[model samples]
Target chain A: MMENEVDGLDKRKAYILATVVYEYIATGEPVGSQALTQKYNLGVSSATVRNEMADLEAGGYLEQPHTSAGRVPSDAGYRTYVDALMSPEELGADERRRIRDEMRDARAQLDEIVEQSSRLLGRLAGNLAFVTKPQSDTQSFRYVQLIWIAERSGIAIIVTSLGVASQSLFELRNDLSPDDLTRLSNALNATFAGRLLRDCDDRSLTALTKSCGFGDDMAAAVRAAFIGARTQEQPGISASGAQHLLDQPEFRDVRKLRSILRILEEQRTLYDLVADAFDSPTASVKIGHELGSEELADLSLVTVPYRFGERAVGMLSILGPRRMPYARLLALASGTAETLSERLHDVEVK
Target chain B: MMENEVDGLDKRKAYILATVVYEYIATGEPVGSQALTQKYNLGVSSATVRNEMADLEAGGYLEQPHTSAGRVPSDAGYRTYVDALMSPEELGADERRRIRDEMRDARAQLDEIVEQSSRLLGRLAGNLAFVTKPQSDTQSFRYVQLIWIAERSGIAIIVTSLGVASQSLFELRNDLSPDDLTRLSNALNATFAGRLLRDCDDRSLTALTKSCGFGDDMAAAVRAAFIGARTQEQPGISASGAQHLLDQPEFRDVRKLRSILRILEEQRTLYDLVADAFDSPTASVKIGHELGSEELADLSLVTVPYRFGERAVGMLSILGPRRMPYARLLALASGTAETLSERLHDVEVK
Candidate 1:
């Protein structure tokens, strides 16, 4: 009974701290005892709330920005709220509908999909967004063909079972009839189709080359084309809406905005962050102060890993101010991740 | 004359302070008074150096991390050193040759060159490197050709007079004969050649479409293809050697690395930074504490813009700990920029 009572007190203290932070985040101003008493039905008087607020301030979660003004949530206060008080809100129907509509017939390609995802997330959340395509090894080969188009132009098309197709163009040095190229294409596809190119070692490529009975140069060219295709299968990072950072109060300093924009243009930074999220599928949120750089401590990041079929492929996320709508942002991030995985699976299944 | 003497004294003080910072950066430790006196020939004794260090500390430029430790340059000290005293040294011939070789053949295409430049800068300087591709409108029209490869595939090849090639693949649904596709390709290319796409308005596209005698569906498809191509050409951002940040003492906090990575991932952040360099081709440096963000005040960024022919195509830069070798880094950045531009012009002239 005594332990239960102590637990209740702790919970109550936590609730008060959370309330103060939440209020401050909404107003962009400090929260005071009278305002807290009037705005929230905490069943506490102004005097009681004031005493508690003082204790919270002393505990380092709340800060008096000035002696005359009320208390504002410190970085610590924001951290506590994000970790404990923020609830996961379900994605609204309209949001889900918009995402689905946007993704419909997005039959472009992996690169297009990643680029669109970034723009969509950025637009939806009014924050920076990033997406990378699924790794190529995970995309099993469905079919392959070679066709001679012009007298000197030849095209190689490889379609993954996942509905993704990659094509390359090479100039023919010698005259090869279209029918001969078709026959060679059939021979190659018969030998390699339905097998994972990623599973094919160098020996496998060599073996297939030999079985196809083509000139060594043509075989080498085909092998080069395959390798090139695989290199792009790892998916590239695409991001958008970085200008949103300028809209936030934290970035009022033009120099700060410039530094941030400089950072964003370096896509490797986004690639690393998104790649890190793949280790864990659950939506992750990083807050200011925790980010280690005092400049970034005022910002927040919410990210989730996306999947290709049963395996995780890459990550997608939103970057916004620390005072971002966490519940909505979390739901949006997770929902988008789920939808991306589902669409990718459908492609593979089809 | 009295005022000039006082100014000379201030300059001496500034020079002594800069020497201390330079030595600390070179040695990666707090600089001792004896070492400062012995190394720079400032004509001061150990006792005088100690007195100056004390004054510098009092002025908030230097600090002792611990009681028996020598003095280290604080963020303020580094800022003062960078702004007032640091004149980054010139690159040696060998260094220039090496940087030029690294940038060789990297400008074959805008996107490829940007990626290569970022990685090469990172590798050469041992710092995080960044580059952003020119805006699409800034690029002149390359020759455009569409080659039909198979039943469903075609390749769009665009070769700029500047030797940059942009390629994209298109998949066809309704069958079109190779001759007919070739005619269509020729027709479209003839209509759009030698003009900037950005200069074409909606009515122009419609007029071009009608004048080319393209069917409604084919015209729509071509428009979509053009728009899709433009989307990919939005802008390119690249960075390499992010792992280098881990080796910096300032980023000892893993959380700080995470935030920096997050900031770096946003290409818009960097695009905004480098775009400013095009305003002037001269080398520019943003030092620690000088950056607007209190969070980023501990780091420094050195950037130089590279030209394509007579026009600037992009900016290249390195990000590192504030205690960087500014002279070497500046030379590396500027040398790489000059090399990239010169080689690109060479390729064009060839």
Candidate 2:
């Protein structure tokens, strides 16, 4: 090992590069070799550290913005640090309790949970925070109930198997008396209860209508409500502390800010992005170059999937400068997901 | 006129600058003085054009990214062009009709219209797009109706004075027979129909309970539904085509992209932005520096308020890179808002 130390400098070079990148991410500034040795106690002299930094630059992990400037992590360097050097610390009990308390106050509404989760994340990360509610497809339908509210108005209430509820209103043409309406309601429940709505096809609709013995007008109304219930499938998405993005140096350009604001206004794209993050179960880190958008290549996303009653249903993540503390962000994201899922399920059980 | 042109260098300069900006917007590149003179036939020599370009840069409206490169519009330059010099061409009949057709297909659903409007703005600007539905507070509640669906389930339908409808559901303690439920529904309509629900205070709640002649369990159920209906009151926001921002030059950095994506997920921020845009009646422009976020100073938002049957209910806008053709984007945003309102009103009328 001692013989190879001088001749093969690969391990020493890797250590110095890793140390510099770690210090840069922690401080959000350029890192010099002297600082790296001092901070990490690498047991190497400043000259050796400088030599390794130069070699790391040649290997594409570290970069010098100017001839005299300290070294900074290139995208490659950050990638290597994220992949090999970082280890996430466990979330402290106080932080976990705080997350649980915040989520508890949000009530059972999915939108509220999403909104609070984002806010909690933004506060925790001190960067931009984003969280998305479970997508409609991910939720199981518990039951669909239709009720007549007025002479011309009817309501459809859909309960998901996961305890989320949604409702929509439609107009009806029937002038049925209360007796007739009561009979129809009973008949509909008997046929439709305990059935998965997505599996309810045209045959099911027809069977529901015929068995209920509802008039054509009532039957048409039921079909319309059924269809409306199916398509009301959107989930809520929330972000917090986006203003904090402006506090970062990378967004100093007014043009860059405008582009970002415009991008933020498109929630559908964001919804898709967050949902895609959940496709991986464990904590996943998507850094610059991995996001597949040239505009997004300078950022890092830390995402972790969350469960609803043991089923992985959605995700929570943070999007920030690529130099973000990946180990901490990853830990925070994972802890948030696990705690949120557990808290939400607990609320439902109660 | 000739004397005015020669003496009024400011006006001519503005014209020449507007020309250069327009040409550059059409082709995402810097505008050289020679190209401006040759392509625009500015009746000036290339040398004179170069001198003017230098003056424009000095005025902070243009910049040279590299020493030998042609000039691009700085954020300030785009601001001046948007506010003072540029005159958007009127929408042709075909473009107007295309916008009308887009709104015509949205049917009677206001939610669908706002969603489609954002997409339309995106297609028009080739950038980010946003649309916000009317705030629930602005509208008065017209009716609340309850219908019994099963032994434990019932649906609550609410219609506002503005003709929009929403629904909710609740569980009941006692199984009110369908006949009794019908009586309760009728009793609710008799007392609450055509009255502003916001005007109905807790005093009215007591009055309603006394007047409905309901049993204790049934009264509790009705009150629950009433509170649910009156308390649910946030407007919806829909947006699309945010991914288009990725194609812009300013967000090419991965850090910028991540921060922007994070901000876009914040619904409250987006809702606030779009709501403020609707506070104006005509085409609204939120330029760099005006947008409150320094990160957004490189962006511009062109928005206009839209109406639902003569009632100003929402706003729709497009988000573009700061160097975008503001004149064209503003015109497109105006046309989109105007056409959407007209077509939606037509649907309402039908």
**Poorly placed runs, candidate 1 (over 4 Å):** A1-109, A112-132, A135-227, A230-338, A344-350, B1-14, B27-35, B45-88, B92-117, B143-181, B194-203, B215-224, B231-234, B253-258, B338-350
Error of 1 at A104 (Å): 8.7
> Candidate 1 — what's its lDDT?
0.68
Cα lDDT, all candidates: 0.68, 0.68
* lDDT by residue (tens digit), candidate 2, A119-188: 8888788776777776555555545555455576655555555445445555656665545555665566
Q: Which candidate leads in TM-score?
A: 2
Please give the fraction of native interface contacts (Cα pairs under 8 Å between A and B) kept by each candidate.
0.00, 0.10
Proportion of the native interface contacts kept in model 2: 0.10
